[model samples]
Target: HGGLVAAGEMTRTYLWRILFRDQVPPETALLLDNNAEFTGTVRNSRTLWQQDFEQPAPGLCGTPALQGGCSLALDAAHPHSTEWVIPARPGQFKWVRASAKARADQMEWDMNRMTQYVIRFRRGNEIVKARTVRLQRALVDAGWPRELHFDVRPPKADFDNVSVTFLYYGTTANLLLDNARLEAFDD
Candidate 1:
């Protein structure tokens, strides 16, 4: 005669006891059961990180910012930089959009021009740099802030880190950076 060996609950209880070496606590098991309901579902795009540079001393070298005090100032002498480490998750995020607001009074010339901004995605030995967006000279005349944007499709699977850098590249322009954000979108 053949019959079912065990139910799902029975198997789960056996494994839990074996793993924890004790009976599952009621509160802990309830919390796990509740969380299991939301697994394998898609949520809204998450804000991986954001920085307004509101710190009293911002940037890697603690550079002083301008008045209003919510931005980082970078020049050929000091290039404000920051980084984020992504976790090792399988198929969690497919694309990333990075954005920031900036303005410059002057820039260093590298035959072409100074880079307004750069985004770097790095994991293991693979590294991808989003194309540099050139700063326009008119912003100085208009005295208005310019928005910088970059969309990066990670080159290889399992990208575990990203670096957002504002480079002066030998330019004399004093670049003002504010409202930097990294957003992840699911496909």
Candidate 2:
């Protein structure tokens, strides 16, 4: 229902015709699926993989999402593991920062190594480079959500893909991730 409404109509077209259209956000040319907001109706043009956990899954969507809807959730009982791939055009940027709003439900347990995002650079089916950023015990265990990011240099001159894999193999910690972003910038 992002651009469509009931009766198989487009809300934007209808609103425009009625002269009641709201302000529309400008189209971005950098990346797609920077936020995990789209349903199956819309395609992610840039990314090869992303998460849309709209349907209820175990420990998923337990709390309100930071942006559009549903965050990636992991519980000790579930031990969720998933990966997200974003298009990497390293020639146009100096660095890419991958970030998300991440938090742990309780602070009494060790958070380090409990959850981590493994960033990988791939060319075709081969992995060229990788870096794993574990959730910091002090930052995420502060009893609140925080914006965590890993500033990564793009893989090599010929690399074409970057992926982040979320892994949790703990028995006592619960984690939540929302509003993921992959930004390639010159600065």
Candidate 3:
């Protein structure tokens, strides 16, 4: 008779038992068979944390307006209407848009608020080569809630820091800003 030689192999078994009295069944035994109790936890662990891209209070010259108010208007002549500078890493982005509102006026104003403007980005002394973004909608359309969405792509290489700025050319009008956010999607 010939016998085979095993080099490196191991076998193990796990056994669990629960003891309950005759009056009641063990609670732990019942939990082992129930699958509904552990439904959504075992899938994914990634979460999203949103940060608002808003300027500080002192940045604007006039009184800081709230979202509840009618419109948000800053002295265009003033240097600092609202300035927001955020640090960004090199990555592909689906869209970059800012949301704002225009005040209701019966008179025929320039409707400058309705017209769109450009958004620029800079890095240090040199300006990053990119196209301008425009404001597309008025706030009163959807009950003073306006949002602008645009597609943008920053250079992947040779860029260290990013400086964002909003430029608009219009007459005096009330501009409302409820909320503004910059969203990026993973490739």
Candidate 4:
């Protein structure tokens, strides 16, 4: 009899808690989203243009970005085109290195003329430096992802902007770019 009564009391207490207990409202969870600016540091490096190509931001063009998100598929139609323009404070960065995993479907392609890409730095209206990697044609023809790294030391004075460009020279090629990074260094 005592065991039965204890069980009944426990069940009643559980039911009462379920019916009368207070919960934290859903509105409280939505408070942080209203703030416009982020207060913390998002990236560790002093990178100038580190584009994972996740979002369509202020400085990109000729990019019909990949369908599900991740990379930029540069439009073959836009030859000798500057894809991204990133602004920088004068003299903030000394050395710059641009790198990416690039691939192409065409076997016989000429990077020297047809598909030349350049990482150019500018100061106001003057071009400070332009760097391009001279990749071997056989390496690209293997149908494997090639790692391209182009480094440049811009003029120590000052620069207004830098451009990530593709000098297609009016030729079409099936190219894919991923994990593109334009990192800046003090040295």
Q: Which candidate is the best by TM-score?
A: 2
Off by over 4 Å in 1: 1-43, 56-68, 88-90, 106-113, 124-131, 135-142
lDDT of 3 by residue, 1-187 (tens): 0111112311110012222223322122222212111212222222112223244344342223434322234445532334445555564342333223333232212334333333334565355745443232222233233444343345555544444444445534344343444444432
Go through the candidates in order and give each one's C-alpha lDDT.
0.50, 0.54, 0.35, 0.50
Per-residue CA lDDT of model 1 for 53-155, tens digit only, reads 7762444332333335557765444654544455434365766666676665653334244544555566753564343444432233334466644555555
- Which of the two, 2 or 3, has more TM-score? 2
CA displacement after TM-score superposition, residue 144 of candidate 2 (Å): 0.9
Question: How far is 55's C-alpha from truth in model 2 (Å)?
Answer: 5.9
Candidate 4 — what's its lDDT?
A: 0.50
lDDT per residue for candidate 4 within 160-185, as digits (tens), equals 88888655543345565666778876
Each model's number of backbone clashes?
Answer: 2, 0, 3, 1
What TM-score does structure 1 among the candidates reach? 0.57
Q: Residue pairs in steric clash, candidate 3?
A: 72-175, 72-176, 101-176
Q: Which ten residues in a row have the lowest lDDT in candidate 3?
A: 6-15
Candidate 4 C-alpha error for residue 154, in Å: 1.4
